[model samples]
Target: MTDYSSISTKYRAYNITPDTLAGIVAVVKKFTEGPATTTIYLDDDHEVKDHNLDALLADSFVKAQKIQRIKIESRKTLGPDLVHSISINFESDMLRVVQVTITGDRDRAILARRELDTLLHGAEYWYSFSLAPRSSFLPFFLSFLIPIVLISALSVFLTWLFGGEVTEKSTTGWVLLPLVVFLAGYFGLKDYVFPRLTFDIGRSADRIKIAGYWRNILLTGIVIGIVVKIAIDRLLK
Candidate 1:
């Protein structure tokens, strides 16, 4: 069996600052040996070209509009024709997913990954690959004891204060779900699941096995379920 013949990395951003963004762009441009095509995707679905990304991120208003993604692509001249591209996907104002796709032989792939590791090591706000570990902790009381307990207690207090008759078991899912959702929202869900399928027909098929897609789905379900549950309760009453 042959290898994937490509290398990719997904970077999750905690909060990408201006300096970090500049570093990210530099790392992306470094993948190519010569001039490359740099494209920026905007929130309005309008994509355009700008070298230093000045047009996309020039001012407060423009930045507020948000650059959804940025891509840099070029071929390597010294070696066999290799497809190299860097995709910077912005999930939100402070969240990002940086995808690096480089094609080459085993040795070259190893070196490229090493360089990527270096970049990831130096990046201040970006998390290297995967979204499951953080969000999965939200439902667990041990993880968010302070806020969960405080909010749960507050919910009971409000029920009494508003004369809703606070019960002995009043602190329940109703109070916790929204707090979990709010905390989950602040953390952000930034990575996307890669297409997973097998084909013997091709020379090589990319097998992407990512942990935490289920966790993300569960988190999403909890959020949606809470919304639906609220609607149902209100309508029934």
Candidate 2:
């Protein structure tokens, strides 16, 4: 089994009718709490309406039902879906609001969920990850930090291509290399990677693809950069 000790879950809720809203309010009241801020999505008009519990309870059934769907989103937001399909129950009296949640690095998601649960004890809630948890952390570090380092190293090494060394006399270039590298890597990786993936409701396949692409690119760049650097150093000598 995959160890969830390293993975954390995010909690959210839907199905927040005025009835459930009132129940949530009463339960949270015990702890001087309130209901989650609900964001409603309307299918007919394609509009989003945000309301706190108080406002939802005050609204008429027609208006509340206009909610069509609702969700309590976590701060760790995922990209919108490219395609979504839903089955509506016309015979049902209440909107079938779905609970949207996600799982991620254990420390962050667990802390957030624990606090949220403490804040709202009675609300129906669930948790999940937008993507599959990495079996390890190396993929994340590689995707996020290594690119910046690689870009910086690439910039500094490229100076040798012109038989120039980064020295105290070129303090400005050394200082600027990281910034230049950051922008280049940001744009380069974004351009190279994002296009290979698509955004969706959950489990971003694109990110997985990007991880593989990033590993390949990082390894390739290092190998090529080292070879070129060695050649340049020899020629210059």
Candidate 3:
């Protein structure tokens, strides 16, 4: 016996708002290519409704429910060879995080995934993100390195500027360190951790590969901790 069926799965996260439901609906329509069954699990009542995306995602209905999760199975499609299952796990926070699990046939799963991303990123109100890339390390490394270098340089330059003996310590160093930490969190993490980074359609995120994303996150956490410690130490003195 030979088995040819292959399944592929991907995990993704998106920052969604009330305004972006239309984008989701459009993606669903394109995916199914016909009427689809959507199961909207509302906190008020958990019901499975065989409705189209537009009705399922109506603004009034959406506003009413504290959505726990949504399961959308493709009912009809131009490409019937693939089975599509989309699970949107909702998190109750200001970020309105939607962790999506996409399971599809192996060959075209990537294509199916691209459709949703295209819509999410193309629209103004939707955003998606994946694990940071290798290039991420460079900026974070710079974030760690540049602060000390700039501060050390400023320390000596300011002393010379003020007609004092050159020293490798200054108030500017302390100020810059904390500000760097604060600014990175305020700007970088805002755009990184949650998915609200300045984005272009279908182009904002890159998947963390099989090398493993958790390691990337953990390493970044360690770097962040070190950076913060340096800042705090400077602040205390």
Candidate 4:
């Protein structure tokens, strides 16, 4: 016959001292690890009952032993487990330190911040860096306006030279012929010349490979002549 016996469990508390007090201090100062909530247990019957765990940990000059164990606990589901132990075997006086390593993207973020600062300091300095091209519509618009002004001035000069004679027979045929030539040229090339020239000048300089520059010029001149003649007839009436 055999006798059955119940098993008894024993609980004990132990002291932890880090190998390197300096290393430990360095780690705490850098905040590399998250804040740890520590609970310390002591033998109430021991003589050194006045010293508490917080006070012992807070001591600036305290040197930890090489083989120290720390108890940690987790508070959240994703958090690390609680009641975990950490062993420290480093030198006691080297200062405990924890350093975080930055990844490549983090370095890039820092560089971007620096560039933004530079841009903010002197924005006008980078204005020429715009993605837009030079010699925009304004130049072409000025070019068109210049020719019209010149033609108007010439018409006025000729009129003045003729002493403002209101004779229809002398000037009617001359004006009507120029006007007919202008209308025929203008209507004939409006679909081709204007768009081609505008596109050539507006687009890349290398893109104007199509020939007929002289033809286009002649067509545009005729159109302008017709319009001018019509205007002059209206004004003379």
Better of 1 and 2 by TM-score: 1
TM-score of 2: 0.30
Better of 2 and 4 by lDDT: 2
- Give one digit per residue, the lDDT tens place, for model 1 in 1-237: 113356354434333344545555565556554445556565569676656544435534444444455555555544454445334443332222455666544555556556655654555232233232233446333434654465556555444433455567554345544556545643443222321111111111111123245446756865775677577779979
Sort the candidates on lDDT, descending order.
1, 3, 2, 4
The parts of candidate 2 lying over 4 Å away from their true place are: 1-154, 171-181, 187-203, 231-237
Winner on TM-score between 1 and 3 is: 1
Best by lDDT: 1
Ranking of models by TM-score: 1, 3, 2, 4
Per-residue CA lDDT of model 3 for 1-237, tens digit only, reads: 111232322223443443454455555555446444556565557554545655555546554545555555454433435555544434433334344455554434456566655655544232223222223567545644654575456444434443455344434344445446645653555433333222121211131121136446745865776677577769979
Candidates' C-alpha lDDT: 0.46, 0.41, 0.45, 0.31
Task: Give the 10-residue window scoring lowest on summed lDDT in candidate 1.
Answer: 196-205
All candidates' TM-scores?
0.45, 0.30, 0.39, 0.19
- Model 4, 1-237: lDDT tens digits are 111111111111111232223233333223223333333222232111111334545433222211122222112121243221121121111122111121122333244334323322332212223212224666546544554454544444345444444353544234444345445654465323332111111111122233246455765865776678778879999
Clashes of each: 0, 7, 0, 21
Question: Any idea what lDDT model 2 has?
Answer: 0.41
- What's the lDDT for candidate 4? 0.31
